[model samples]
Target: MDQVPGSPQEPQDARGDDGLPGCYRHPDRPTGIRCTRCDRPICPECMVSASVGFQCPDCVRGGSGTGHAPRASVPRTIAGGTIAANPRLITMILMGINIAVFIAMTLDDGRLLGDLVMLGRTPPGYLPEGVAEGQWYRLVTAMFLHQQFAHIAFNMLSLWWLGPPLEAALGRLRFIALYLLAGLGGSALSYLLAAPSQPSLGASGAIFGLLGATAVLLRRLNYDMKPVLILLGLNLAFTFLWPHIAWQAHVGGLIVGAAVAFGMVHAPRDRRTLVQAATCAVALLAIAAVVWVRTLQLVG
Candidate 1:
């Protein structure tokens, strides 16, 4: 009669065909090593068995020996709090250029080049001779100009403080684009809103734009923006409260910066490259339109 399985005395074969002498799970098997946890037959290869059980390689990795679960991989993000990036190089170069220009203008005797470099726009009643003749360069040239040590100091300090992370995030070319466009926006707005009698100078307008851009970009990165907002608010308030300041350029630069950042960061389709290009185009048009209106008013 065939004995039922799990009988107290299952027939023990003294010699197995494999020649290990018994089932691998059997105590008598020369290599028998049942998994302590599962009590399953485990050869040397399958046996990690001990207090845990004969743990297979899969069990050791996926099961609960160490209880250290597997981790999901996260995409890399920008490294903040470090100035060792590409933007710092650009900032240093810009600072050097501005300082060089300042020194040259200071040494030029009558502040002649300095005044022109500073984009001290011609007075309303009197345009600089030949101003209408391709002096459009002044609009751009003015961005690099500064009237005094304090002016450049403040602007450069702001640049130093804000430029690194922004440049890292946006790249050197894009950072420069934002600065130039923001500068143009500021200058154009200043011309548009000026007393026509007043002259303007300094890179403060564009620096303000960079600040705005920084705030926008940080926010997009999911940063806690309470501090940034407070800082921006205080600066805006100061711009309005300070009598000598031209709030117009600051306002213009800020708007342009926000627009640029929005386009560069939040554009829906593509990798934001198209959005950046479109942003530049639109900002240029806006600046042009403002300049056109100002020129008409000036010539009229």
Candidate 2:
């Protein structure tokens, strides 16, 4: 028989090879501690330290009617993230950054775009600039760079529309992670496919990522998917048909955004934190690999 946490008895444990009990939520994780309320095994991530023995997430949320809850239990989102009073905080910050960068570029006599735009590599005879020459920051800076008013307006509007719900659902940290990773994914793909000398700059890739995440979120919540689908379809059409558009960035961001959002919304409750962390890690590794391969191709 298993014993609850702080039990005086040293009971035999049959559930684990090491004579320890496995967590109810994550059976693979062996632990001696159990939730005081339910006497259920709990791992470190699932256990919340209290005045009494550690309580599980369920117990903490339900209060267990034993006064084990915190003074003020924080509200949670659908994705198990802490709910924010202002769901649009991250969205507004992102918009501000884009706007600030645009303003700076506009006031700088139009010379800043050359420095901020994405450039994979310059030819051997050309100046020693771009990613191959160790100017890798372009991959990031390009995401925030925009030269035209129409470009910034369209992207900022899209961010305002799509960013708040995602920021709320995934919480600030995860939402920012999704946005940044999607942008990097777009930059990497464009570097790999486009001409080394080609200059590309815009928030389109990250915004496209938001669009994909919005679609995934809608599907997860069982909301009507037709609206998002129609919107995404229209954008894809524009991506292909429009002149001077880097379709690679649009395609890459959409795929990466959808993938990260799927992981965020569909991770199992017992192992959600682990799953979300793993999902972001995997996406990051993929982006690094793409950049590495492209760097090799550009320099070689």
Candidate 3:
């Protein structure tokens, strides 16, 4: 009896001289031999003789092969167990607030006051031609003002896209602190750059800080930032082309944001969160000093 190639061996009803199933490797009517490749019982006719022993037809011709191993998936959480571990929700909320304020500024009759308080544009300090000395409170307020729909729309869109990842990395409180500090930093920079009589207002500075934060965090986390760098470049180019644009605020915010992100991402793992927060506090104080000096100058 002879067996066919690639067939599994079964117990022979009639055994050969060696008491084994017949394999096809031999031309004899009966020769019991096991295929070395599959280890299956074969008759002499089915066996494909290899150098060491008989190989199965599938192994001999290489008709079938073992598949490559699949890659493992990445885990969801970091060591800290942060849920979803990204601050997208926080980003949306901040964008919403900015948009709402912009709408209010558009609707309100007291446009100049909105510019002063929401954008920190103190006319007496920077512009010198404004009415009163006691109106320095606008330094903090002016950060929230936007002169046009396009201005707020652009800033909020940037914030919406960039804010969540940073908020997630820094956590909620630190994210908020960095944002406010960045705004103040931008306003201070604008004050420094603007002529004594020019009024400046907008959230672009704060949004620029978010870009800075993104750059620093991505670098520290070993994340790729090709897309973000391109976006930042485009915005900067636009700033240079547009004369009314406040380049000072954007630069200031970027520097402060980078500093804040560095403190957060690179501080000792045990003390990183606290250190990042302190960095924001320091930025705020620096801006506060500017506000204080400007106020005194206005008062005099």
Candidate 4:
């Protein structure tokens, strides 16, 4: 059911065609009841009955037992998402998946890699494969696939270093969204630019996305930007100079990640959820358009 503001107590007559405000916890659900303490809009599920009005989960949790609203600070991340006890949970799961996939690739030889690696369109002699031939899944799988030791090691190390902090700051959901979108951005660009038969795979694009996000977050928090900028510069240099590196992936992921993180952290408090969703939607739509155009080129 669509959540719209107004109940018998909080009737539709009061809303007067105003834009629906999403519940801070569940953005899809619309609600009119604002928390007595934080003033964040809340759905019935997240609303706890206070002495006067409903309180949000955070307020209830932080509030003292005297039925008074919380004086303590709510546990929320920089991006306004609830902080998790284990900040690195998503990162750990992602690393596990990558490691498991790597082990599978090792045990099964290049068979898994052949299927999972990113390919645009197979050459004439090759079997029907790649995105042009309707095997678009290669784009998603490729980011997690790795056949080489050094490749996985570098990416995993980068993930270990960068993933936890971003996860802590952005919260798990936003962090994962940023990571996947960044990887997909990388994959899409690689597909668009690389030759059809040019097989590529790695989490470097995702890593680079995190790198870009780290820089953005650092700058947003008023931290020194020189370290990340210098690191980005060095990586860019290596990407161009090194053989077998798909620089397109790095560039694409960085752009998308930084853009998404910007929206996540910088959205106006009143419109944070909508703005964040819109930002991700825009990035996805852009990638989809790129994929469509490239598909036409490859098949035509």
Candidate 5:
């Protein structure tokens, strides 16, 4: 048989009486090809094409040596399917829920504005009522309700801007947890500080939380933070200066968001899930403690 100059020459033992050699990896299979580097018989499935000829799996693995890096695994989820690890699915779902709730409120009141406002004076034991009266769900529901077009518009705009990137970074579940906890933090603070007759509603708390988280993530990545810091300062100024803005929620969310983001970014890779869970638990407990103290004050 005519042999190519650069091609590997088959070994004399490559063929047995049957004119085929058993595969080095799988003795049951017969093969006509031998590895160029190791000169071992290899089946087609175990063959890796090389410049001169096919190489066996062992030879290919050996050639790569200790420098061979394993391919990264894509995670389908990180937090029990509460959030997806990739894309902005959770952000869109949140935006949709908020919009739907706003529409329902508008229909009920037949007004473009002031339809779903949660007031402090809202009768105790009623839905959307004050936390002092055991209407604890208000802490979560209020985050979804908005008073007017401009109100929902601004909050949704901010959500759209900040949510996607953060969601991508933290995965869906973690981002959702952060958002809810931050909003709860805001509501807890507002419940504690605002007068019994004072009314508050909106997703500003969650938005502010996202802002704070973004700032923390940027700082951790060593990116320039001047732009984010300036934006945060302006929003905080507006929170304090604007009338009926629920600055308490803004402040509360900001603080909680920053704390959560810090824990998430600094968590060790091996113990990430446990650490994240603990961090979330601590945040929830802190908010609950505030609520407990406030409840006692109100009852007294």
Candidate 6:
């Protein structure tokens, strides 16, 4: 098959019958340009513009040893070296735990209307003994137990409403710490003030703590405090007017929550963690001191 040199080559059309080249990724779509890196025809939708020229999606994404540089990392929520996609994850988990505990309590007790209440005074059940008898765990457990549907409902609603924002404002660790400390403060005050024989249980103390923290933080931001003040007043009134309500717990939680929030908002940026830790420690110590004094008085 000998051929003459410089013979005319057959003319070939780069475009298809539609007068444009079919896209490499989408055979139905037509494109006039090709990827600079891979030289693959791509439609506008599949094209990613590079500094020098355009690139196909595959080339831009560095597909299959294409040797393109990896893209920058996406933004993520990183708190104290912990990564989470959702900022409100901790708040949701706390809510779920509370609901699960309530369900378990209801199932175990066989009485939906009453029972499962934790009392400050010693009774026939476990962990109900007063602080005087060194039943300290009661302080923590009492915060999770609620008597009536309305009781848990109101408290959980408050938590759901306030928890996410507070959790976001204060990192997960700090938020959880604040919640527990406030609940402990409430229990301690209840133990000190409530009759030694009286019984009490509810998450109202923690909810009140949230409310108090919100008030303090808002005030620190120099926002108007009238709305919070009115809400606080109404809740206080309800606490006093309602029967079997533990006003002592509410007041104690409010005070401690506010104090902790104050420290959190006022601390210097360089020493925030240290100041918050110290503030929490001092608040817990104060509660313990009050309990110790009250226990001594009761024992004497």
Off by over 4 Å in 2: 1-72
Instruction: Give per-residue CA lDDT, model 3, range 1-300, as digits (tens).
Output: 123444444333545554544444332324445556556554322333333444444444553323332221221111111323344677777777777777776678755543464232344345433312445455556677777777787777777777865665565666777787788787777765565345666777778888988888667544456867998899889888888887888888888877876776566545645665677678778877776676455455
What ranges in model 1 sit over 4 Å off?
1-85, 110-134, 269-271
Model 2's TM-score against the true structure: 0.76
* CA shift of 103, model 2, Å: 0.7
Q: What are the Cα lDDT values of the candidates?
A: 0.62, 0.80, 0.61, 0.80, 0.72, 0.68
Give per-residue CA lDDT, model 5, range 1-113, as digits (tens): 12212323334444444567766655555666676666777653354444334555445544622333332223212222222323578889999999998888878773333
Output candidate 1 Cα RMSD. Answer: 21.4
| Clashing residue pairs found in predicted model 5 | 83-172, 83-173
lDDT of 4 at 249: 89
lDDT string, candidate 6, 53-122, tens digits? 4455455444322455454132111111122235467778777777777887778764431334444455
Could you tell me how far off, in angstroms, the CA of residue 250 lies in candidate 4 after the best superposition? 1.0
Off by over 4 Å in 6: 1-84, 110-118, 123-128
RMSD to the true structure for each prediction, in A, is: 21.4, 12.7, 21.3, 12.3, 16.1, 17.0
Taking all chains together, the TM-score of candidate 6 against the true structure is 0.68
In angstroms, how far off is 160's CA in candidate 1? 0.4
Predicted structure 4, TM vs. truth: 0.77
- Ranking of models by TM-score: 4, 2, 5, 6, 1, 3
Q: Across residues 1-300, which tens digit of lDDT does each residue of candidate 4 receive? A: 334333212423222134656676556646666777767776544544444555665665656234444453555565767667677899999999999999999999788888788999988778648998888888889999887899999999999999987997788889999999999999999999988889878998899999999999878755557879999999999999999899988988999899999999887766878999999999999988889999999889
